[model samples]
Target chain A: MDKGIDRRDFLKLIGIGGALIVMDTGRLAGAADNKMAQDTLSFIQLSDTHWGFNDPKINPDFAGTLRKAIAQINSMKSQPDFIIFSGDVTHTTDDPKERRRRMGEAREIIGGLRLKNVKMMPGEHDAGLDNGEAFQEYFGTTHYTFQQKDVNFIVVDNASDSTSSIGDTQLQWLSAEMEKLDKDSRIVVFTHRPLFELYPQWDWWTRDGAKAIDILMPYKNVVVFYGHIHQEHHHMTGHIAHHAARGMLFPLPAPGSVPKRVQIPWDNDQPYKGVGYRSAVPKKDAYGYDLTEFPIIKV
Target chain B: MTNIKYLLRIMVVISAVVLAFAWVHIARLAAETQTVQNPVANQGHEQVIKITVKRFDYTPNKIRLKKGVAVTLVFTSLDRTHGFNCPGLGVRTDIVPGKSNTLRIVPQKAGRYEFSCDVFCGDGHEDMSGEIIVED
Candidate 1:
């Protein structure tokens, strides 16, 4: 519960120097490429909507909550440039047809957004049942890379393997990408589960996360944002700052802090407690992201 | 008929603007990560810093240094005794009042190594910590 370490302040101290730039191999060189290199873009990360989930005791308004969260982002005066759903977009289903149906329904629900660029990866709930066959059909590519504001954004699919390993294939893809960046270049990684072993018993730890960390260990400014834990948490694996986003569905107990990994019964008093989403604004004064948590809209 | 043609022309213009706006976003997202032609050199000159440790916290809790630079952190405890343990970076040391203690490190890589007091000094021992940032 006590994050103890002070990463927010430490990251603020990381100087941006100048806008770090990387041109597309051949086409669109020069200042034309720098258009997106500006650090003013902001994005929101909404995780674990768990569409098709039906548990009134834990979340009576599960369906309503999911829509309202999207509406809340839609209503923002300054709409985010992008949205990254960390994982578990739908409730886990054993039936193959049902899984695709849930994915379709959930995609339609999230499609209500006014903006596009809604990037999503899979979670064990969506992928583990079939090694991501259902999810990839709807979302395409379990893992990939993109860039914004001179900062490289990588989405690593740890959920696809079911065992929660980055897998040798994806890890090699990650290493190849890592090799391309300058040591001082800024990088932000997104994963469904925590990259470091937070609580293996509770499935918080990635099977081969340490190896991924070793690959990313050399970078000067690399931050990993993930979801799986239903509650907000922050931890430090050396220099890399790992922050977990709360689920859009229901909240779970802290790692082994409780007897079981059960969801806390929905509270009428604090319906949105231990649950919400995160928005990150690239700090203009410095080099890293300034992250803030936002609650789901009640209406 | 001329009015109808004009309306069609206006619609085409609006669509083009919309299409162009979308392309910028697509292109940005499409941009690939490339290997650095010449990565920054890791090694730098040596440096030194003075730090103070106390109950529940560390003074100047954040320190920044260049990667591959050898540096010594001269530490002194204001109260009893505390420890600076950074397992990630493999750097640890004890801070004792009226005693000489220091951590000499040459960070081969750039990272945010969070060091905390390993020895339990008091109830506030957990909060007694600081960060060492090695940059390229």
Candidate 2:
């Protein structure tokens, strides 16, 4: 209870302290409020890395930029408990060997970080071949549920079909998972596609997102984070707050604003060049999430 | 008197005649069908605008024009797949590698319009964005 520490610093300290304590506790079960009193578990998100891309127009130092993101995350005075790579781990290609090579390289780079834990979800690019069997093989289960403190963290594989979709089986699994959670538990969901309709014409939305939303409606505190649009966007529906993160790669124009869905090329003369970052905090309001965003340019 | 030579000559003449006829037939088929028309070029007297989509950025990040003026956007993708989309103006076109895409849009109302690539081209794919400004 040091009064001198600022709020962010205090949170960071708590996060680091909590991670250490959790590591010692061995069992994360029933240690919620006790852990909260001593420390808080804060995690960092890195999305849409699209590794193995060698476009000189982006950054001949693309790998270097990724290393920068990792460095920034690691340099946080209070290290994050874990890191989640939201999606798009690699560029889309038909060659299986090429896909594996790209993913393997990305994994090696991320593994170089030596973090305690890392979680990932597949984007349309990663899941280009049906249910993302290759992605799952390289990574792990595409959809699964986990718990940290009193929060129920559900990572869903929405990039299951041609259009971003959480198949009926996944939906059923989601429904069953929610039934077991406590009424007061906070729910944080992650996916690679926007759960809400951003732009259907360009396939930016999940076809069965409304159904997934319906499943979470019973929860009082629900927050959903997705990465695909590659821009920072926040929307609220009932008790749920949906957020889309800026991509680590390039940015896309706002939906329906451009003549077509096309890549906005790079300009060398611009002051701000590459990468973006977003931070979110639980709002003071009973049901709200506040996000602060900024562009991370290469030097 | 020269039956073998005459027979060989006859075969060669027949082969040449067949090839000539086939060539004309193929040429006729090619001329009969019109190629895919450039959508923007079809709009006569429209204000022509050029848009270039390269690796990770758009050439004129912002486009400004007068309202109600017909716009003919001629776009080409320098690299992979790129999209030019303006939801407000109901314009969405995809530019593929080695192909040119064009669209004709007439904005009736004056406002700020945003455009972005829907394709995941590369690492910087998420940051690709541009804008169109329509004024009265």
Candidate 3:
């Protein structure tokens, strides 16, 4: 690997190459049929499942709802190349046994989908007890970089520290990793906490996320996705776009909009009105990402 | 004879100290086990209310009761973290997932008190709110 070519930049190069193939074809059907030839890679991002949570005040069938979401993903005509669970897999406590149990249950449910690969990050809830030691034990490395084709996927663990510090080691690793990739490569950063300040009072912002963003600023094609706020929010700063996914567990109020944060109560008469789903795709410029969100409703 | 009396007095003192220590220990245990008595014990009668915290909503969202009545609320979280907070009543407790959290509240004033989940459970978390109305 070249010193300036990071995994993300490399992945972006692959994405660009893939997009170029599609652009050359200039036909949707042809692009779809020749996806592999086009080098188009797709991945699913699911966030804030909050498994093992049973709250009648919210929904009695939270787990079932999550299963349905998984089913929806599995049933998609074009299966994602991989699945990324943004974070908050569990409600509270950092107990290893409980964490393991929840992870097992999630795996079992997702396993039925028979997906090829599932990658995960931890949310604050998942990292409540021991700085995500239990979560890391159940899942693999919290933060890592992977390259598929020409796109670089950087999975960082913001939940590992209370102040949301990427830590010196991870920062050094990221810097060195970025040094290996070309600046034009497309990069995707995934974490449980939003890299920018979403809402500080509710502990929504990562304290040291600016440090991570500072490092990523030099990259031309960078996109970040996170799940902790439990709602769909999108923003852009310079070349990077930030997106937050809707939580599968329940719906929360927007920051500072409510007098205080509370679990949105369930209305039996109006079931399935609160949940939402977010989808993203590479923008036309190939330097940004566009998002579309739909609220999940019972038919 | 005088020396014998002195020995007897020492044994008596030792026995008295042991008895006092045992008495204090037993008293402490009793106090630890005893439930804190309601200050308004004779102020009103007891009432039972069931509050369910589930995904999206709460059943019987509006809880109505008589003022000064002792309320025993049985709360349970249906899906995730739900908080039962009545700032007026100064009551706050987190209803954990899969477990029931019981609370005893004796409203001191004759007014409408509001309650909501403080934890950010999901998307509609802010809208997931309710109230407690106390009548005369």
Candidate 4:
């Protein structure tokens, strides 16, 4: 695998978006790195585009950045089976008209991609204020499950409630869903916020995520990918692997790294610093997923 | 011998009664203090209370004040950054590192208010919480 050999000059040689990274997640904590699944499907995970956010210092070219990423993925030789946008498709706004406008613009931009199978969930910014009203108009459902290549893909809606809770009723729904799956079934969970308390004070945690984790614990093979931290973070809750994606907009600092949880200063020298997306391809046995972090398309 | 034993028993009973009276008196004084907050402050004077916060706790974990009284809550961080968030009182302020952050709050009602450092301190950040008791 090209990822096996960490060529220092490889990234520079290929330029920004020509990244082909294949990380065998076996080395990641709680990731078994079991024999790769043969019949498993591959998909792209990107998050937090914040479509309507306007900050010149943070990202003056917000629309351009989103367009470029979509264009680059479309140009890929081999397309992913599907793509999942974890959350925050649009930035939060108090104005109802402006909120719908942003979602409409986001829908237009994302439609440029070559693939048709796209799954999206709302983030606190997109749905917290009106409880997924605008997002539902653009996208179909807040939370639902789909199966692809024998993998049960569960989308949990934790951002619909502004209070950062999955709620008890949704928890029961998740519990009932888990009862139908086999202990050895391959599961991939997509949500907006980290299911565990990565950092509660910064709103980086779900209020009742612990209960959701408790439900998923019975399964031997499970992984979670979420976006809200605005930077890539990998964590382990029991044997489950939870990975946070780098936001499509500007990136925020590490959890509690500074007095304020603000965006890292943008440098004209490194405009695309700390922004990227990931691709997860299953190995032969499909017991685990290997992630590839691709840099933002040069705009 | 019987008179001596009776006298000893009477002495024990007297000691128990005296201790019980003292306990009741102390309890009443504490209750009065809680209701009164700090009676030393004269009218129209703003109560100034300085508090410091560290890793996972506030030094003065509880603050007592009287209703309709304005208080200047002076806050400082002994180590890194922290916050004082009393949603019940509609007051929020950050505790700057090596600096003093202050907020003035006037309690309109008598009740218990909860506050915590909103900044992500560490694993035990949730523990860095306290209460504000406003008395009528």
Winning model by lDDT: 4
lDDT tens digits, residue span B10-101, model 1: 99999999999999988766543211222112335546576777876776678888888788777888876666766557776768899999
Per-prediction TM-score: 0.60, 0.62, 0.60, 0.65
Superposed model 4: Cα runs more than 4 Å off:
A1-39, B1-136
User: Per lDDT, what order, best first?
Assistant: 4, 1, 2, 3
Q: What fraction of the correct interface contacts does each predicted structure contain?
A: 0.00, 0.03, 0.07, 0.00
Q: Model 2's DockQ?
A: 0.08
Candidate 2 RMSD to the real structure: 11.4
lDDT (tens digit, per residue) of candidate 1 on A221-261: 88898998888888888888888999998998887675345
Alpha-carbon local distance difference test for all models: 0.75, 0.70, 0.68, 0.78
By TM-score: ranked, best first: 4, 2, 1, 3
> Candidate 3, A93: how far from true, in Å?
2.3
Task: Name the docking class for model 4.
Answer: incorrect
lDDT of 2: 0.70
lDDT score, residue A138, model 4?
A: 94
lDDT of 2 by residue, A1-299 (tens): 11322334334433433454434322221122123223444456678887866676755566676776665444344444567889888877767788888888888888866465888889878875545878887898888998765567899888745345688989999999989987667788998898887785556877689999999988888899999877777788887888888888777778767656655556665422435555444444355544444344343
Best by DockQ: 2
Candidate 4 residue lDDT tens string, A1-299: 11221223223333554223312221221121111223457788889998987888898787688887786566454566789999989987768899999999999888877888999999988887788899999997999999988789999999887667799999999999989999989899998999997865556778789999999999999999999888988998878999899998788888768644667767787677788787787655556677776666453
Lowest-lDDT window of 10 residues in candidate 4 chain B? B35-44
Q: Candidates' interface RMSDs, in order?
A: 16.3, 6.2, 7.8, 9.8
